[model samples]
Target: MRRPAFHTRLRAHASACGGSSLIEVMLAVALVAVSALGLIAAQVWTAREARAMSLRESATWIADSIAEATRTPSVGNAALNQWSAWASVLLPHGDASVGESGAVAAARVTWASVRDRPTAGDGIGPSAEPCGGVDAPAGSSCVALAFAQ
Candidate 1:
């Protein structure tokens, strides 16, 4: 049985490169799992920020709509109520308020969400809003307009 010189070299190389140990494989898997978990966390944060931005955009739209309607004689508390109802339906614990004094008007919308995955609404969550509810942090969006005298 005469094996080729190359066969002997191959056997020596295989012995030298005995693949990964159990600990090495475990460590590699742990690192991969950690990286995946970090990626997932970042995705979750992005989703939350996206949702908050959407709510802010919607609030701006609602404020603009209310301001436009404010010109009509029939627009007042009823319009605010309708918009409040609409906002409530659109966002969790959503509320809308409109205030007018003389020639100035202000519209604000507030909502709640667990943007930072806080165990509780500790008043220190990321971008905490003054209008949030009990279980989540609050966020507010507002706009003000003045009519010509």
Candidate 2:
């Protein structure tokens, strides 16, 4: 057979060197892997943020439900200190010793999940003695009123 021409030899030589360098190929693969991992991390963070926001909204809605329950006539002995939701109500019982405890002035709120989860001493049961837990000295009859969430 006739020997190959000069042009064919040059073309073959260029082809032998034309493919990707090993280091360059490996670097490209690593870059793509890193970008994929970053996208996954971003997705996870977004899901976590969304879950936290949803929990906060649920807590606020539970509080609103308790307030609305107080407005209903069926809420027995209900007041700002004794409002009841369809599920539960939080009542306060501050130690009369603390004269200016800010906790008494605020509603004693428990998440609905607390009741649903059923912990050791938690449920949709009697919370506290509602009436006599208000701003009274101890037995001054402050109408025994407060509210819950």
Q: For candidate 1, write residues 1-149 as lDDT tens digits.
A: 89999999989987887775666999999999999999999998888789878877887777676667666767766787788898888876777766656666566666665444543356554554332222223333433333421
- Candidate 2 backbone clash number: 5
Candidate 2 clashes between residue pairs 3 or more apart in a chain or in different chains: 80-146, 80-147, 81-146, 81-147, 131-144
**Please, what are the lDDT tens digits per residue for candidate 2 over residues 49-146?**
77656644543454454445554546623543343342133222221111113433332333222122334356543343243343223211112224
Clashes of each: 2, 5
Pairs of residues at least 3 apart in sequence or in different chains that clash in candidate 1: 129-138, 132-138
TM-score of each: 0.68, 0.44
Best candidate (score: TM-score): 1
TM-score of model 2 (CA atoms):
0.44
Q: Give lDDT per model, in order.
A: 0.66, 0.44
